[model samples]
Target: MPPTSVAAPPGAVTAAERSLAPDLARGVMLLVIAVVHAHILHTLAHGGAAPSGVADTVTTVVVLAFGEGRGYPMFAALFGYGLASVYARRTARGDTWPATRSLIRRRGRWLFVFGILHTLLLFFGDILAVYGLIALLFAGMLVRSDRRLLVWGAVWAVAGTGVYALVNNLLVADVEGATQVLAHPLTDIATRAMTWPAMAPLLLITSVFPFLVGVWAARRDVLTAPERNRALLARTAAVGIPVGVVGGLPYALVSAGVWAAGPGTATATGWVFMLTGYAGGFGYAALIALVAARMGARRGPVATALAACGERSMTSYLLQSVAWIVLFAPYMLDLAVRVNGTAAVAMGVGVWAATVVLADVLRRAGIRGPAESALRRLTYGPRHSARGAAAGQPAARR
Candidate 1:
C-alpha cells in the first residue's frame, strides 16, 4: 500500500475536505454513548430496577447486545487512533519528537482540565480525563512498531482485566447508595466527585488496552485510507461483533436476572465481558470505515449531519450530559422518577437527534463547535499566517 498523505494544516480543512469515516463513526457512536449513559442515569432514577416489564426486558436486552461495555471502548479506540494520527502528522511535518510530544502533552493537559470541570458540574463518569491521562502516559508509544503495539495492547488488556477483577473483589460499591446521591442537586456533584478517586482507576485500567489498539490502527492509516484496507475492515467487523456479543451474553443474562451466578464468578465474568469490547470497538470502526469508503462523496443531508456531529464530537458529548441534567436531575425536570427504561432510551435518542441537527446547522453556518474552537486555540495559539512551512502548520485537531 502507498503511504497515506498527512492531513492539511490544522484549521485548513473545510467541511468539503473532511474525510467521511472517522467523523461518521464518531457521529454514530455518540448515539451509542447517549443510550448507554441513559441507561445508567435511568437506573439511578429508579434507585435500581431489574429487567421486569416487557419494555424493561427489551430495552435491557438491546443494551446488553450493543450498548453497555461496548460504546466506551469503541470511542476510546477512536481516541487513540486520532491521537496517533496527530503524532504522525506532526513528526512527518519535520517537528522534533520533543516538540511533537509537547504538543500532545499540552492537548492532553487541557483535556484533563475540561474533564474535571465536566465531571464536577455535569457527569461523574467523564471519560475525557481518563483519555487525557492515558494519552499523556502512552502517546509516545505510537512511534513503536505495529507488532510491539499489538503485543503490549494484549498484555495491557489481560493485566488490566485482572486488576479490575481484583478491584471488584476488594471494593464492591453499593449501587443503591451511589444512586441516592443524585436525589438532590447540591449533594449530587459532591458525591459524584468523591466517587472519582475510586472510579477513575477502573476506567483507566479498562481503557488502556483498547486505546493502544487504536494507536496501532492509526499506524495503518485505516480511516484515512479506507479504500486501501477494505478486506481488513470487513474481516474485523465479521469477527468482532459476534465475539463481543457472545462474550457479553453471560453478563447480560446475569444483569437481567435470567442467569444465576455467585458474586465472585460474576465479577470475573464481567471482566471477560469488558475485554470482548476491545474486539467490538475495532469491529465498529472497521464497519463504519467500509461504509464510508462505499459512500464516498455521495453523502446526503443525514450523512452530512452525522459527519458534522462526529467532527464536533467533543461538544456533542458535553451537551449530552447537559440534556441529562435538565431532564433527570432532581432539581430540574425530575423526570427520572417518572420515566421507565423504554422512555429513557427514547429520550436519549431524542437528545442525540437534536445534536445531529445542531451539528448540521453549525456546519452550514461555517462555525466550529464551541469546545473544538476553544481546544484548537489552546493547543495551537492564534492561527498564524499560512507560511506553508511544514513546521509552521497548526497542530492536528484531535
Candidate 2:
C-alpha cells in the first residue's frame, strides 16, 4: 500500500500532457470496434447466415482473422493504462492510497451505471459495465508488486481462455438462435436486462488478463514514452501480430467455409483463436505507438483527426450504437436483412469516418465530448477544475 498521506487530488490530464500514441491507438481501435460490433450485430439479425457469396466469404475470413476477439482486449488494456495514470497522478500529488482507491471505485460505479443505461437503451453487448465491475473489484490490485501483477495476469489468462473455449463449444448454437432484431423496443430492453448481468461477469473474467498487462506496461510508461521503448515495441509488434494472424487462420478457414472440420476440431480452433487474440491486441497497440513515434511532432490532418476521435472515444462509441439502432433495427431502417457482410463492413467504416470528422470539428471548437464531459464531472465532482494546479501544473482546458 502507498503511504497514507492526504493531499488534494490531481486534476484531469491536459491535451498538452496527453500522449499521442495512446490517443492514436484508441482512435484506430474505435474503427476496429465499430466494424466488429457492426458485423456481430448484422450476423445476429441475419440469424447467423453462412457466407453466401464471394464477398461475404472474403469478409468472413478477414474479420475472423483480424477483427473479431481483437478490439475488446485492446480496449481493456487501454482502460488499465488509464487507471494506472490516475493512480500515478494522484499519488504523485501526495494523495493516500485508500483515497485514490475510493476515487477509482467511485468512477467504476458510475461506469457501471453508464453500461446499464447503454444496455437498456442501446446495445446489449455493452462492455462499460464489465469494465466498471473490474474497476470495483481490482482497484486494490493496482498497488500490488509488478511480479504479482504478471503472475495473476497469467493465471487469469489461462482460466479465462479455458472458460471462453468451453462457452464457445457449448453455447455457439444457443447464441446463434438468440437473434435480436429489435422488433419491439420493450422486448429487446427486457432481454438485454436479463442477460447483461450474466454476461458482464464473464466479460470481466476474460478481460482481466489484458487489463493487468496494460497496468504493467503503464508502470514503465510504455505508451507514453514510445521513443524510449522503441526496441521492445518493435519486437512485440513483430512477434505478436504474426502469431495472432497465424493462430486465427484455422478458425478463419472454418468460418469462411474454406475448410470443413469435425465439431471437435472447430472447437479447438475457436479456443486457439481466443487465446492468440491477446497477442493481436497487444501487437496493434505496439504498432500504432511505433507509427506515432515516427511521426514525432508532425501532426497531419488525418493523424490529428484520429487523435481527436480517440480523445473523445466514449462519445464515438455511443454514437456507433446510435447508428446501429438507426440502420439495423427492425423497427428502423432494417438494413440488416438487405446488407451482406461486405456491405455491413463498408457501412461501419462510413460511420467511423463520420465520427472522425465530427470529433475534429469539436476539437476545433474547443468543446469536449458530451459523454466525456459528463463522465469527468461524475468522476471528479461538478466543481472540480480541469486545472492541474493542485499538482503544481498549468491550468488545463477541458
Candidate 3:
C-alpha cells in the first residue's frame, strides 16, 4: 500500500495542526447535535412532558437553561468556519476559485446523500438533509462579495428563524398547532429538505449566511490562527449568547409549555426568534471553534474522543437514530413514553458521553470511527487507483 497521506488542500492549516485538532471540534459539535433530536422524540411520545425523576428534573433544567438552543446554533457556526478552512486550503495551494468551488460542490453532494439516508432510515429529524439542499443554494453565492454574502445571509437567517418560531407554535383549533408541521414525518422531512417555493429560499438564505460567515472566518484565518482571533470570538459570544437566549428560549419554552401556544392558535411567536436565533446559533459556532482551537489537539482525553467522533460524524449521527429507535420505539425499548424532559436529556447526554469514550478507544486502537472510515473510503478510497497503484487505504471498506 502507498503510505497513508492526508494532504491539506494546499493551505487548509499550518503544518503544526495537520494532526487531529480540527477533529476535536467536529466531535464535540456532533455530540451537541443530540439536543434537538431528543426533545423531538419526547414530544412525539408524551405531547411534551415536564421534568420527572430526579435525573429527568436536572436534564429539564439544563434544557431550559442553555442546552435548548445552544447546540444547533453552534453547529451552524462551525459549518461556517469549516467552509473557510476548505476555501483557504485550496487558495493557498494555487488552486483557483473554480477548483475550490467544485470541491465544495462534491462535498455538498456527499453531505446531501448522507443526509437523505440519515433522514429516511434513521430519525426523521436530520440536519444533513436541510444542509444538503441549502448547500446547493449556498453554492450560488460563492462569487458574492463577503459583505454581500453577510448581508443576504443575515436577511434570510433572520427571516427563516422568525418564520419557524412564528409557525412552530401557532396552531389551528382543528389541527394540533405546530404539530401540523410534524405530520407525515418523512414528507415533512422531505418538504424541508427539497427546494420549495414555501421554504427553500428562506432556509437557503439562513444557512448560506452561515456558510458565508464561515468563508469569512476562514479567509481571516480565524480557526487556523485562533489566538489572533480571540477578541472577535469573544465579541461574537457577547452578542450571540443573549440573542440566542432571547430567540431560542421561546421555541423550547412554548414547545415545553413554560409559555403558551394555546390549544388552537397557530404559533405566532416564531417570528421573534428569527434574527436573534441565527445571531445566537452562529455565535455558538464561533465560540466553540474558538475554544477547541485554544484547547489544541492531543492534550485532553475528552478532546481526543470528541475529535474522533467528529471525524466520523456520518456514522455517529446515523447510529444515534438507530439507538433512539431501539431504545424509545413503542415496539422497541419504549423508553420514550417512560421518559420526560430532564430524564430524556440525561439519556441523550449519557449517549453523548458514551460516544466520546468509545471514539477515544477507537482512536487509541488505530481505528477510524465506523461511519467515518466508510465515508473516507467512499470518497478517497478509489483516488489511489487513478494514480496507477493500489490504494494506500483499503479500496473498499470492510
Q: What is the C-alpha lDDT of each candidate?
A: 0.79, 0.84, 0.57
Q: Write the per-residue lDDT of candidate 3 for residues 1-398, one digit (tens) a residue.
A: 23334542232332223334345556766655665567657755664444345555445544544555455544555666665566666666688987777666666677777776765555655666566665555765656687887797677666666555544443222333233123344664464445233333344444655666666666676666667778887888788877767655654555444565663332544555445656766566567657776775435656656766765566677777777767666656778777566566567777777676776666565455566444444433445223212221232121
Q: Per-residue lDDT of 210-266 in model 1, one digit per residue for the tens?
A: 888788888887888899999999999999988888888877776666777788777
Of the candidates shown, which would achieve the greatest lDDT relative to the real structure?
A: 2
Listed in order, each prediction's TM-score against the native is 0.91, 0.93, 0.78
Q: 1 or 3: which has the higher TM-score?
A: 1
> Could you tell me how far off, in angstroms, the CA of residue 274 lies in candidate 1 after the best superposition?
0.2
Worst 10 residues of 1 by lDDT: 385-394
State the lDDT at 145 in candidate 3. 81
User: Which candidate would rank higher by lDDT, 1 or 3?
Assistant: 1
Segments of candidate 3 deviating more than 4 angstroms: 1-22, 48-61, 170-205, 261-268, 293-298, 377-381, 384-398
